[model samples]
Target: MIILSVESSCDETSVAITKDGKEVLSNIVLSQIDIHKVFGGVVPEVASRQHVEHMTQVFSEAILKANITIEEIDFVAVTQGPGLIGALLVGINAAVAFAYSHDKPIMGVNHLFGHIYASQIENEMKFPAVALLVSGGHTELLYIKDHYQIEQLGSTLDDAVGEAYDKVARSLGLPYPGGPVVDKLAHTGKDTYKLPRPYLNKEEFNFSFSGLKSAVINLVHNAEQRNEKIDVANMCASFQESVTDVLVDKTKRCAAKYNVKQIIVAGGVAANKGLREKLAEQIKDIEIIIPSIKYCTDQAAMIGIAAYYQNKIEPAKKDYFIKGDSTLDINQS
Candidate 1:
């Protein structure tokens, strides 16, 4: 099946053409990092406007690169929610228009589900798997027993890991979209700052990054007050180590508790080299799957893969209406 998917849940305007959900014929993503970098974070109105400006061009490029005409597309898939409503609407409306014109089936996919399925693009997902989804807007742990059967194992009570990373980077005078920047700096220094690992001993699977974030802020402020030269790289390395330690430990405990056959890390933060290395070193008994860097971030190919499964499990009706839902929950969807 040829699936054309659109994803504009956030700052990226993306489109992809996939064959049988596994093979991506063409995946095109136009990032707004250059635009948002000036503001130090995403501006919803700006993101929405940019999507409107770039959606058409991005879609066309994906189709052209796929070397397939609109007539060859079997279905249209799009991210419908759990993102900025305005940004989400851009993709949904475009997809709705295409499906309406082509008279083809259209599936509304949950954005988080897209993140989880991203690993499937390169590795076949095993049943009874545990997924650790870490992103700018969300931090969640999920248990998957089948294609449609998913349970929320845990989630962050305050700021998501990516949010914490950005905030910490800003405090250290790092650039916007701080996760990758921090990860790169982390490798150059040692973890000498001794940052606290929040909720490390908690029995529940929930996460709490707020305390850790505050700790970093206080450490930075204290050093500045004392006029002491701080080691920015070492601080970054220390912060990353604390976060990675908690994430890996919790995920390992969950995998053992649930007796899952495999573990998959998904979402944008899953691209962190620190987290990937930690998982590789810690989770030795079970299968571990992490999507390639390209698929780890927001993209349409993952949405297409998710829609393929959604279509098989619950086909959309002819009159089904697509809408943007910023708070759409994956477990309920």
Candidate 2:
């Protein structure tokens, strides 16, 4: 089946044409990274406006690149929530309009489910797997018993890991979208700053990054107050080490507790080299699945893959209606 998917849950306005969910015939992502970089982060109004401007172009590009006509599309899928309402609305409305015009089936997909299915683009996911989803807005651990069946194992109590990474990077005078920058710098230095690993002693699967982020902030503040030269590389390494340690540890514990067949890391933060390396090294007994870097960030191909499954389990009605829901829960998807 051919599916055309739209994703505008965040700063990216993406459209993808996929065949059978796994093969991405065409994926067009118009990123607002450079635009938001000037402001140090995403501005919701600006993102919404940009989405409006680019959605149709991306949609046309995806269809053209996929070498398919609009009539060939079997379904239309879109991210419906768990993101900025304004940004989400742009994609949702676009998908709804397209579906209505074409008289095609429309499926509303959860943004988080899109991230989880991203790994399926490259690797076939095994049942009874544990998923660690880390992103700019969310950090969650999920247990997947089968396709489209997910249980929330744990989540961040405060700031998400990606958010913490950005805040820490800002404190260290790093650029916006700090996760990649910090990961790059970390390879050049040793973890010598001695940062604390938050929630390490907690027996539950929950995560807490606020304490770790605060530690980095305090260290940077103290160095400035004392007029001490801060080592950016080493500081980045130290912070990355602490964050990865907690994430890996909790993920490992969950995998063992559930005795899952495989472990999958999804979301934007799953692209972190540090986290990937740590998971590969520490969790040796089970298969580790991480999507290609291109699929790690927000993309419509993942949404298309998720829609394929949603269609199988919960078919949409002819009069189906959807709206942007900022707080949409994954368990309820």
Candidate 3:
């Protein structure tokens, strides 16, 4: 089956074509990183504008480069919600229009499910796996009994790991999308500040990064008041150490509780070099399934894979799609 998918859930606009779920014919992503850099974070309006400008070409190039014609597409897939409203609407509307013109089946896919199903591009998926979803907007642990089943084990009570990274990096005057920069600097400096690992010993898998973020802010504020020069590298290192510690501990606990044979680390933070290394070293004996860096974040190929499974069900035909609540359930993920 030829499935064409579009993703504009956030700043990046991506389009992809997948055959039979596993083979990726073409995956094109136009990143708006440079556009949002000076602003320190994504501006919803700017993201929406870029999506509108690029969505058309992104879809066209993806299909053309895949050596396929629109007539050959069997399904049209798109991310429906739990993202910036404007950004989500861009993809939903585009998919609807395309499906209508082509008379193809249209499927609305959950953003989180796209992340989990990204693994299909690499290898066959086995059920009963744990999903560690870490991203700019969300941090969640999920139990997957099968392709259509997902139970959120626990999630953040406050800020997500990536959000914390951005806030902490801003404290150190670093760039936006701070997780990666912090991870890189972490290697050069020692964990000198001993940053707090919020909810580290909590009985449940739920996390709380807001406290950690506040801690970093307080430390930086006090240092500025005292006219003390801060070691940015050490600060980054200290912060990442705390973040990774929490993720590792919670992941291990979930694995033990569920007794799963595999763990799939999904979402943008799944591309974190530090997090990947930590999981690889700690998750012994069980297979660790992570999409390649390209598929780790937002992309349509993953969306198509999830839609393929949902295609078994009749899709709801609609010209307009609703933007989902931020707290939308991951069971659909």
Candidate 4:
């Protein structure tokens, strides 16, 4: 199936064309990272405006890059929810127009499912797997029984991991999107601060990063108050260590408990070097699948991949392609 997909969940305005959900022909993403950097984070109104400005251009580019006409696209797939409502509507409205004009079927895909199914682009997914989804707005552990069956194992009680990373980065006077910067600096320094690994003592799959973020903020604030120098690199390293340790430990335990065939680490934070390396070193038995960095973040390709599978299980109807749902549940499908 040739799937044309739209994704304007947050600061990214993306469109993609995929063949059979496994091969991505073109995935065009226009990110507003630089624009939002000045504000320290994404501004909803700004993101919505940017999406409106670029949605048509992105769609045209995606089609051109794919070397396919709109008629060749079997169906249209778009991110339905779990994102900024205004940003999502831009993509959803565009998709609706495109679908209606082309007389093609459209489907609203869950953003979280897109993250998990993104692994299909690089590797074939195995059933009965556990997925660790860590991103800016969400942190969740999910049990995947098959392509059509996924259950939420646990999720963040407070701020998501990526949120914690960004908050910690701001406290340290780092850039807006802090995950990559923090991850990079972490490699240059040692884990000297010895930050706490929140909820590591608990056996549940739940996570909590609010406390960890606060600890880092407090440490930085205290050092500044005393006029003491703060080792930014070391602090990044320590913070990354604390976060990765708990995530890896809980994920491993969840996989073992379920006796899953493989583990899929999805979401934006899956691009973190620390989490990738630790998961590789620690989990020796089961296979671990992490998509390439491009697929790890928000993109239309993953949404297309997810929509392909959904179409296989149940074909989409025009009525199903309605307005966006900001809080669409992962297990809704």
Candidate 5:
């Protein structure tokens, strides 16, 4: 089977061509991080407009790179929900139009599932796995009972880890997309700030980054008010320590509690050097699956793999189109 995938769930406009579920033919992503950098976050309208401009060229590039014809594509898939509505619509309407034009089967994929499939680039998913989705907009703990069955055990009660990273980085005068930036700077200094790790001791898998966020914000503001010279590198180190500690602790607890066979890490923050190192140290007994950095961030190849798996459980059709759905319950195996 051949699938062409589109992902416009955020500032990145991505397109991919994949065969069956595992073989990636072509994956092209045009990032608007440069455009959104000045704002310190994604702007929905700017993202939508950029998608409109790049979507066409992305599709063409992906197809040519894949060395395939439109007729060779047996299915079209797109991320359908839990994202900025305008950004989501750009991809959805594009998929709807492509499906109409090509008379192909259309699949509406959940964005979280796309993150899960990023692990597929490395290896096939094992049953009874755990997925940690840490992205700009979300931080979710998912229990994968099987290939098609996914259950959300817990998630962020307030700001996501990536959001917190960007905000904290901004407070420290770091650039936008601060997760990697902080990760790099953190290596140069010690964790001297003693940042808080909120809700780590909580009895559930749920996360609470808002408290951690506020704690860091207060510290940063206080340093400025006192006319104190803040150690930027140490601040990054301290912030990342708190974030990594919370994530690793919770994930390890969940892995032990559920007896899961594997843990797959996904999303943009999956590229964090600290998170990866901490996870490696913490998850010694269980299998740890991390995708190639290409798959870690938002891309259509990940969406194509997700659609292939989703199709195994239930087919996505034109009639089931969804947009901006935070409560979407995508069936798992």
Candidate 6:
């Protein structure tokens, strides 16, 4: 089946075409990072407007690159919730229009589910796996028995890991979208400063990054008051180490508790070199499945993959249209 998918969950306006849910024919993503960088973060209104401006161009590019006509598409899929309402609406409306005009089935997919299924592209996934989902707006650990069965193991009580990263970066005078920058800086520095690892000793799968974020901010503020030369790279390294320790330890403990043999790391933070290396170094005996960096972030290809799996359990209605749901849960269809 050929699936045409759209994802405007945040700052990206993306469109993708997939075949049989495993092969991505075309994945076009127009990012507004440059536009949002000046403000040090994404402005919801600005992001939504950009999505509206580029949705058509992105859709057209995806179709052209896929070398397929609208009639050839088997169904339409779009991220309907768990994201910025305005951004989600843009993709949802585009998808609704395509499905209605073409008389095709339409499936509304959860944005988080899109991240989870991203690992399925160009690869086979084993069931009964534990997935650590970390992104800008969400941090969750999920238990996946199959495509149709998923349970939330735990989630963040405050800021998501990606959000914390951006906040910490801002505190350190780094640019917006700080996860990658911090990760890169961390590689060259030493963990001289000892940052607290939040909830590392807790037995639960839940996460709390707010404390860590505050600790970094306070540390920076205190050093500035003392007129001490701040070691930016060292602070980055230390901060990353603390976050990585907590995440990897919690994930490992969760896998052991659930007795799952497979572990999948999904979402934007899965692209972190520090996190990936830590997981590889710490987690032994279980198979770890992580997508390439491209798939780790928000994209429509993942939405297409997720829609295929969603369709297998519950088929989409030909005449049904969906609206954007900003708070869509992972367990909800």
lDDT for each candidate structure: 0.92, 0.92, 0.86, 0.93, 0.86, 0.91
Number of colliding residue pairs in each model: 0, 0, 0, 0, 5, 0
TM-scores for all predictions: 0.97, 0.98, 0.95, 0.98, 0.95, 0.97
lDDT of candidate 6 over 77-112, digit per residue (tens): 999888888888888898999899889999899888
Clashing pairs in 2: none
Task: Name the lDDT of candidate 5.
Answer: 0.86
**Local error of candidate 3 at 176, Å?**
1.4
Tens digits of per-residue lDDT for model 1 on 230-287? 8999999999999999999999999999999999999999999999999999889999
Query: Which one wins on lDDT?
Result: 4
Candidate 5: tens digits of C-alpha lDDT, residues 46-165: 999999998999989999999998999988989886688899889989988888888887877888888888898779789799888898888888899987678888888889999999
Candidate 5 regions exceeding 4 Å error are 316-333
Residue lDDT tens for model 2, 51-156: 9999999999999999999889998989987899999989989999999988988878899999999999999999899999999999999999999899998999
TM-score for candidate 4, please give it. 0.98
- Can you write out model 3's per-residue Cα lDDT over 109-131, one digit (the tens) per residue? 88888888998788778878988
lDDT of 2 at 120: 96
Per-residue CA lDDT of candidate 4, range 1-333, in tens?
899999999999999999997999999999999999999999999999999999999999999999998889999999988899999889999999999988899988999999999999999999999999999999999999999699999999899999999999999999989999999999999999999989745779999999999999999999999999999999999999999999999999999999999999999999999999999999999999999999999999999999999998878777745644526577786
Candidate 1 vs candidate 5, TM-score winner: 1
Q: Report each candidate's C-alpha RMSD, comma-separated, in the order given.
A: 1.3, 1.2, 1.9, 1.2, 1.9, 1.3
Candidate 2: C-alpha lDDT? 0.92
Q: Which stretches of candidate 4 lie over 4 Å from their true place?
A: 323-326
Evaluate residue 250 in candidate 4 and report its C-alpha lDDT on the 0 to 100 scale: 95
Of 1 and 6, which scores higher on lDDT?
A: 1
Which segments of model 2 are wrong by more than 4 Å? 323-326
What range of 10 consecutive residues in model 1 has the weakest lDDT sum? 317-326
* Steric clash pairs (candidate 3): none
Candidate 3 deviant stretches above 4 angstroms? 313-327
